[model samples]
Target: MAITEIPKGFKTLLPDEANKREKILTSMERVIKLWGYNPLFPPTVEFLSTFKAVDEKFEEIAFKVVDRETGKLMAVRPDFTPQVARIVASSFKDEAPPFRFYYKGKVFRDVEGERETYQIGFELIGVNEPEADAEIVSVVVNILENLGLKSFQIDIGNSEFIDGVIEELQIPSPTTFIKLLSSKDISGIELFMEEHHISGERREKILTLLDLYGREETLDKAAQIFQNEQSLSAVKRLKEILEILKSYGFESKVIFDLSERKGMKYHTGITYEVFHPLLGCSLASGGRYDQLLKKFGRDLPATGIAVNVDSLQLLLERKGIFKEEKKDFYIIDLKKERKLAYEIAKALREKGFSVARDIIKRSIEESVKTAFGKGYRYVIVLNRELKTPHHIYLSSEKHFPLDDKNLIESILTAVKEEK
Candidate 1:
């Protein structure tokens, strides 16, 4: 038998990374909950058909297995929105409108080989209004700000804005147009139009307009080239959304990208991606998927956003924002004064401090050295033979008698004040 090697492009998170990741995730969940978005946990594996209903491309990268007894094909979920939609359509059909739910979990996607990705995202279902969009956008912005991330931009785009323009052109197999738009391949789009014998002043205008890819001004430029009512309506919607974002005071962080078109197959209206100076890719991506609920037998509108927690941690680390604080410990000598030591340790523990009592019957020097080496700040020494009471010793200072009971309170109070 041969010994197997560890997998590539995948690594375990060590103590430091795990601690930072946990803190960021906790903050994200806290903000999400504060925004009235309840948490939901869905299974990591589901039937293959559940995901295929959203996009066939998912099947290519999905890890699949066959049930031994039932012989049903199952897949590890590559995304959460599909499963979330499945849950809502199945269980919350009779529930009221505007269901806001948040989730944080691992999603498996086999990009090259089997790789597991973790993401934290939220879904706002049964609400099509711009207020819901603003709420979702604002929630994400708030989470990022709360994480202490600076120098980030949230680029907003509308799928319908581009789709409406292409629909009016009646370009057969608009996949070419979509690809060219997504890749910012202006030459390819022009060449394709030429091959299709699309020669006119409007064609020249559209080709020139593809370069309009940033800021609110781009919307006006796109509106000029797009004479189709559907395209114009999409432009109007984009402007309205931009206005909403501005009203939220996130206008500076918000930028418009007309050529930005990822996740467009499932997304019906507004789509957004968050970028930062440190990340090579977007830290988070999401938008409205109005048609997702319809697949689950409910014809309701919905939208969502998903933050890549792993990527977010990377950004935070690169920005030097997520440094872990040293753990504080209170060490007690249980052997010297059993009763007093237990009482002091119990008191410290009751105060919500991490208390590590030294049970070893070692010399005072050995205990003090051990506690100091182990990163304990305060060491309480109890001398049973001495006439005086227990004395608390600071690692920075020498031992002293603390005769007063209020001294313990004073020490804790001082520590709290320092923090």
Candidate 2:
């Protein structure tokens, strides 16, 4: 007997889908690198405590395994940022003030039944000022525009603002109130407020004034409700970040959501989530984790953004922005000139063409049919002649001389003319 099923929430990516994902990751990585971020590849597994150091919440969903060598506990990487923190403390401890790194990898979690998803993210360590946070936010906004995203918004908020709101409300169970507010239970929130004797002006302000704080005026309206220094400071910082975004001409792509306090436990300051009208969930999210590095023995300030490649790929595919790459030339060997076939394939590839040689022992007609079916635009049938193979266009009966002297030029001309 054999196991025929993968676990629930896990899925394999075939060629087409995988190609889309890779393209999305590539575009994101390019932008991240341009912003002075070097690439870092964290291992797929680490000690369970590495992740738990950031947040014990990871212990629940993290896939744990026992190490036989040391008999200590280890686990598959549930997230990359924690591993980055570990590296910063253990490896780059004596380095410098500001360290910038970007990464692309998969993270495992049991939130939706033990699924693994790809993440392409940037981590800027050793910077505490709001400029660091602003840079991260602007980089993401730049990425969205670079990827041709026309309609999207980043919902920004601060944990201090949220905590102040809870304080101002003076509710019995802040935890329960937060849960209800997070789920947007209008009736439930009202009932809870009534239960806590939170009526009159406070209730009216929350109900009518803070429906959706997207515009600048709404930010002011929301600011009027919170009186605590932390919340007011959160509001002031948000306005400063907005001014910075305005300098980048990206203020239009931003909105404020004071109710957004739910994120990774490590996010201690301003947090944000990316949204589009078409997707039901956030496409990317990040925040300032000023205290995460302290767990690793380095009290460094950090901020970063993590893009959900799986979700981004889904959105791109739905928009038909990315498609499966097609082969440029398919080599079908008719005379069994194996050496010539290999040489021709290599030559085509060297000339910037994607070529695939016929591996299956099949007839020329069958091979040609397969090439056409697989979306190849050019097909070459190799025979006894070393100097020339019949280069046939898969779309029509047109043929070109596949001479060694002009192999690249001929293909380039053909592709240019086709375009």
In lDDT terms, which candidate is top? Answer: 2
Count of backbone collisions within predicted model 1 = 0
* TM-scores, all models, native as reference: 0.87, 0.93
Per-candidate Cα lDDT values, in order, are 0.79, 0.81
lDDT of 1 by residue, 4-113 (tens): 55666566887778888889989999999999999899998899999999999889888899978788889988889999999999989899878989998888877874
Q: Which runs in model 1 stand beyond 4 Å of their true positions?
A: 1-6, 170-173, 186-203, 332-342, 358-376, 381-393, 396-407, 410-419
Encode model 2's per-residue lDDT on 136-234: one tens digit a residue: 888998887888787989988888887877677665788887678678888888898888888887787557524746767656876777677888888
Our model 1 lands, by Cα RMSD against the true structure, at 3.2
RMSD of 2: 2.5
State how far residue 316 of model 2 sits from its true place (Å). 0.5
